[model samples]
Structure formats: structure tokens, C-alpha cells
Target: MVIDSLLVLGGLALLVLGGELLLRGAVGLARLLGLSPLLIGLTVVAFATSMPELVVTVAAGLEGRPIIGVGNVIGSNIANILLIVGAAAMIQVMHPPRGLAKRDGAVMTAATLAMIVLAFAGTLFWPHGLVFLLLLGAYLVGSYVVERRSGTTEPAGEAAEALEAAPQTWLPAVGLVLGGSVGLVIGSELLIEGAVSIAKSVGVSDAVIGLTLVAFGTSLPELATAVVAALRRHADVAIGNIIGSNIFNVLGILGVLALVTPFEFTSELLVFDIWVMLAATALLMAILASGRAIGRGTALAFLAIYGIFIFVQFDTGFATAVQSAVGL
Candidate 1:
């Protein structure tokens, strides 16, 4: 069990390192190809950062842990808003645009509401997949449309950021990406195996692990990125990283899973975790709409909320199962 835990942790480390390398290589390649930074950020960078969740979800679904696959997405998004953004704010001030609360926030809210509605409707199958994909298409098209209407060569300040990268050191970048991506897959395989082993050894369910460890493990990059962005006073990167990553976790990660696994929604998920996810999203929206930018205190509040949620999730099951076994 100890060995398995070590392997899972080690695998996660490699996954994160690989993802970072992939991002660097991808940025260089995009620049060499004359792709705009916003294009790269929105697609390449966003996808690269989200690769861990993508890899892990596929692994989970393939391993018949579809709950983990789906739960990881919800947990990661909640962590993105609470833990990641909160940790970022603890480092520096984050003044998200009021427009973000109005626009992208609405989009996120819509997605959350849609998922809830689906959950209430019973199992999420192909129809849910189609809806998710359609919304994803709309988002991509909307971004493109907005960019075109602005009539700007790049989104505001994007051009300046594009020129800031070093020259195309594509050779090493490619090597890193390849090595990292391979390592990520290998690591993901090992991590899932270890997590399952540990869960069984300790008498925890796969869903619980998905809600906590696997979910938290997959979210390490978001936490790290947000922390760094906050320290650098790059709150846009922090906010964008969280939002973009969440979108990809659903639209990209789950999209890939559906393509292969056709995830089946479980009563366990609807009863236990999905409501928490919706509440967390709503809380984030409330925070965004508060007219006050996220600061240290706001971040602290998020951390507290997340901590409470985690405790409730674990404590409930632990009490029920362990107490029942003990004839309590």
C-alpha cells in the first residue's frame, strides 16, 4: 500500500512536469507557426495544462471507475475556484473583470445548470455528450466571433505577451513534450492502479478517492499555476487558467472519455457529489458577482468552504461504513 501511494505521488509529479514541458514546447511551436498567443493560450496552453485530467479521466473510465472519471472533473473545477484561486489570491490581488462575472460566468453557470438538469433527468449518456459538445462548439465559435468583431490583430495585450517568449528552441521543447507526454501516460496508469489499491486496502470506495485524492491529485497543476500567477500579480492568468482548465475538464476531458467509455451516471454521484459541485459553482458565481475582487480574505473563505466540503464527503462515508461494521 505504501509503495502504491509512493508510485501514485511520483506519477503525479511526473505528470505535472510533463505538462509544463508540453506547454513550453507547445508555446514555442505555436509562435514558430505564427499563431496568435490568445489562440495558443485558449487552445494549446489550456489543453496542455489540462492534459493530466484528460489522461486520468480516460484511465478512470477504462478502469471502470467512471465515477472517478466524472467526479474528478467536478472536484477539480471546485478546487480551481476555491483552492487554486484562493491560493493565488493569498499571493497577490486578483481583480477579475466585471464583464467576466457577466459573460463567461454566465456561460459557466449555464454549463453547471445543464449538468444538474441532466443529472436530475437520470443517466447522462450520448444525449448529454451531444449537448456538451454543442455548447463547446458554441464557446469556441463565440470566442472567434468576438475576436473578429474586435477587428484587432490580437486580443488586447496579447501581442505584447506573444513577443515575450524566447526564440523557438523547438528541438529541446519537442523532446521535453514527448518525454513528458509519455511519462504522463505511464504515470497515469500507475497512479490509477495505486489509487485503487490504496482505496481497497484502506476500505474507502473508489468514488471517495475520486472526490478527494484522485481529484486533488489531478488538480495539482491548476493549484501550482494559480499560485505562481498570483505571486506574479498575473491574476488574469490565474483566472483564465482556472476557467479554461475547468472548461477543458468537461468539454475536453469528458469529451474524450465519452468518445471511448460512454460514461454512465450513477445514483451515488447524483446523491453524494453533484449537488456539492453545483453549490460550489454557485458560490463561485456569488463571489464573482460580489463587486469586490478576490483578495486574501476571499481566498480564505474559499479554502474554508472547500475544506468543509471535503470533510463532509469523507466523514459521512467513514461514519456510515465504519460505524456499521462496529455495530454502532
Candidate 2:
């Protein structure tokens, strides 16, 4: 038992570390290919961060555990806001950028609403999945086009010049990218496996596990990235990472899971978690558009809200435990 727990912890550690390394290398490569930082944040970085959720959901769906997949998506969205953003804000005041408030805020809200609507449909079949994917593609393309039209500068030239001036070859860069990908995959796998084991041991449903453990686990990368960005005072990356992650948790992970393995929608998800997800999304929007960036007070409010949510979840679980103990 101890060995299993250790392996799980080790796997989780590997997964987060791997994801960070992979994202750095991937972002560098994207920049090398002339992608603007904002576009990279929206597309490349967003997708990279979503990969763990994608892997966990897909794996669960394929294994006939639809609850895990569904729970994972819903849970992840909640975590992105409550845990990731809250933690980042607590670490340092996170202010939303002007573009974030004016544009991405609306986009994130729409995506959240779309997920709720899709959840009610009872199945994430190919048609629905395709629609989500198309929306994601459109968003990416639109962002890219806007970047180009705005005459935004690409950091690729600087990166390439730096590489040329340094005593380095393409081989090292290629190795870093490959290594990062491998680490992310392996780490995510181990983390998911551990999560499932832990859930079973704790006598919780897979859905709850997804809601608490798997969701938070997958959001670790976001937490780290956002907090670090916040400390560095890069409001755009800090806030962008959170908002972008929320979008991908719905559109990216859910879309891919539906296409790969259609999940039977749980009405419970609609009743409880989806509303929580939407509420969290709304909170983010409210904070961003309040005409002032998120400050210490806002962060405290988020943390408090998160605490309430967790308390409610635990209360429900404890009630179930009591009921079971008394044969209710």
C-alpha cells in the first residue's frame, strides 16, 4: 500500500515537472515559428496546459468510466477558477488586462455556457464534439489573424538570433521538446492512475475524485504557471493562463473526449457541478470587468468562495457516509 502511494506521488511529481518542461520547449518552438506571445498563450500554451485533462478524460472514457471523463471536465473548469486563479491571486494580486476584460472575458463566458448546454444534451457524440472543435479552431484562427492584422511583433527573430549567436545546435532544442512531451504523457498517466486508486480507497465515487483530486491535479500546471507569472507581474500571462485554461477545459478536453469516446452526460453533473463551473466562470468575468484588476480583496473573496464550495462538497460527502453507516 505504501509502495503504491509512493508511486502515485512520484508519478504526480513527474507529470507536473514534465508538463512545465514540455510547455517551455513548445512555447519556445512556437515563438521560433513566428507566433506572437499572445497567440502562443491562447493556442499553444493553452493546449499544452489542457493536455493532462485530455489524457485523463480520454483514458477514463476508453476504460468505460464515463463519470471520470465528465467529472474531470466539469471539475477541471471549477478548479481553474477556484483553485488555480485563487491561488495565483493569493500569491500576488492578479489584475486582468484590458483585452482580457473586453474580449477574452466574453469568450470565456460563452465557452462556459456552451459546456453547460452541451452537458444537457446527454451525450458528447461526434456531431456535438465536432461543433466544439470547430469553435476552438475558429477561435485560434481568429486570434492568429488578429495578431497578424494588428502588426504584432514576433519574438521568433530574437529567439533565432539568440540561438545563432549561442554555441548551440538544433539537436538540443529538439531533445528538449521531445523530452518534455514524454514527461507530460508519463506524468499524466501515473497521476490519473493514482487518483483513481486514491478515490477507490477513500470510498468516493469517480465523479467526486474527478471533482476534487483529478481536477486539481490537472490544474497544477496552471497554478504554477499563473502564480509564477503573477510574482513576475505579468498580468496578461497570469490571467490569460487561467482564462485560457478554463476555455480549453471545456472546448479542448471535452471536445476531444467526445470525439474519441462519447460520454453519457450525467444529470447530476448538470444539477450540481455545471452550475458551480458557470458560477466560477462568472466570478472571473465579474472580477475582470469591475473596472479594476483583481486585487487582494478580490483574491480573498475568491479564496473564500472556494472554501465554501469545498465545504459544501464535503458536507454532501459526509452526509452520504453517515447514511451508508446507518444503512439509510
Task: Report the C-alpha lDDT of model 1 over 38-147, residue by residue, as the tens digit.
Answer: 56655666667788888888888878787777878888888888788888888887887666667677777777777777667755566567667777777866876666
Name the regions of candidate 1 deviating beyond 4 angstroms.
151-170, 316-328
- lDDT (Cα) of model 2: 0.70
Q: Report the backbone clash tally of model 1.
A: 0
The TM-scores, one per candidate, come to 0.88, 0.85
Clashes of each: 0, 0
Residue by residue across 1-328, what tens digits does model 2's lDDT show? 4655775677667767666655666666766777556566557666766777787778777777868877877877787787777777777766566667676678789988887776776666888888888888887787678767878645232122223332233455566668867876676667667767877676666777777767777777777766766676663456766676677777777888888877776545555667888888877787777757666677777778777766665576664664565455
Candidate No. with top lDDT: 1
Q: CA lDDT of each candidate?
A: 0.73, 0.70
lDDT of 2 at 268: 52
Off by over 4 Å in 2: 31-39, 154-169, 316-328
